[model samples]
Target: MKDHLSALVQKANLGDREALEQVLLKIKDLVYNLSLKMLLFPEDAKDATQEILIKVVTHLSTFNHKSQFKTWVYRIATNYLLNHKGKRSKEFAMPFKDYTDLIDLGHSNEVRYTKNEGELSLLEEEVKVSCTQGLLLCLNEIDRMVYILTDILGFNGVEGSEILGISSENYRQKLSRSRAKVRSFLNNKCGLVNPENPCRCTKKIDFLIDQKIVNPKDLRFAHFSDRSIDLVGRIDDLEKSVAIYRSTPNFPAPEELLEEIKTTLKIN
Candidate 1:
């Protein structure tokens, strides 16, 4: 597969439009999902995915094959996301203290349970995905990328270090600290992680709907499918905290975005 992808890269660099499209197709989901996790918004992720792919195509000739093609792609995606200062990133740059305060705003505001089983399921899934992304935003960009690459996406230490351009020791230390922070937050506040917590998804459904934060009619992150990171990748031993994220859906890139990217590049 690596050899095949390298051939695609070579063809793409030689201005073969079909090979360029094929290469983009291969890595589109990876770039999009990483952008989604980093930006926490589907629209923003789609835009960032397009930008990253353009960069990938522009730099196609520079790939030295010293590492796997996927790793090189990951390195590019992570570097873009790490330095990304989009509108959403600015709004989401709060520390845990601010995040806790936001959660506490709704902590005692649970409305009455009032939705059918179908709607309840969808809304709960939305809350889970949204809440998980919110929790990740509490971490700094580097630590967040480390946790996502190592824990959620199941990249090992060496791969994570390579993707982030950091030493394996530094990657491991960041992973350890990031995991502890997320675990601690989940233990204290997330009802899914600890039944003792009061922040149930069911309790937030009506409030989210009323506030236009989440719409049952237009579900964003919650798809009615069984696909998750579990089916798509490895998660090491699946520690409890990481398990919370691994169970969430592996979101796909927008259906029309790939064609748009090709058109933008003027690929015939």
Candidate 2:
């Protein structure tokens, strides 16, 4: 795959429009997913991804071959997101602690008696998806990017460092701090991490449903049948816990969006 992408990059650099389009197609999902994770909103992520791709196409001729093409693309993405000045989603403004508290209060005996096991499971998945995405937002931009690259997306330290334009040591330090923060938050508040926690996804389902945060019939994250966070490969103890939340399947860029990008690039 790397060799094929390298060939595509070479052809793209040589002014082959078809190669350039293929290159964009290959990396479009990656760019969009990273933006979605970072921005925490679909529309914002879509806009950011589109902007970044345009920048990448405009600068394709300047890409030095010292790094892998994937790494270079990521560097473009990371830099774009770091400096992006856009309003964050309101969902991210609410503190995780406040979310937990709301769940605790909402999970009264009356609610528990009303919801069955299947309903509770569905709700838990929604909360897990929403809360995990929210947790990433809690980190500052750089830290958040580091955690997403290394922990979620499975980039190694060297590649992650290259993408962020930081030393490997610096990358490790940032990743450590980010991981620690997320781990602590989950252990304390997420029922998936600790059974003792009062914020079980099941308990929060009714509350989320009542507040319109989650709709039972039209579930968002819960209906993604292709992948779940559990599928992320874990290398060691550090990843064991983080993987639980980061294991969702890679989100694909919309087909129409890809076509729009292709047309904008004027590929025949």
TM-score against native, each model: 0.90, 0.84
What is the lDDT, from 0 to 100, of the residue 158 in candidate 2?
90
lDDT of 2 by residue, 1-268 (tens): 9889988988998988888889999999999989888887667888899889999989988888777887888999999998884465544545556645654566643454245766666666776686678677777789989999988888999989988999999999999999898888877776666667777556666677787766678765666633353343443454445767556666778678777777787766
Please give the TM-score that candidate 2 achieves against the real structure.
0.84
Best by TM-score: 1
Could you tell me the lDDT of residue 23 within candidate 1?
Answer: 93
Q: Write the per-residue lDDT of candidate 1 for residues 34-89, one digit (tens) a residue.
A: 99888887878888899999899888899988888999999899999898866766
Q: Which stretches of candidate 2 lie over 4 Å from their true place?
A: 85-91, 94-105, 108-123, 215-219, 225-240
Against the correct fold, how does model 1 do in TM-score? 0.90
Worst 10-residue stretch by lDDT in candidate 2?
A: 225-234
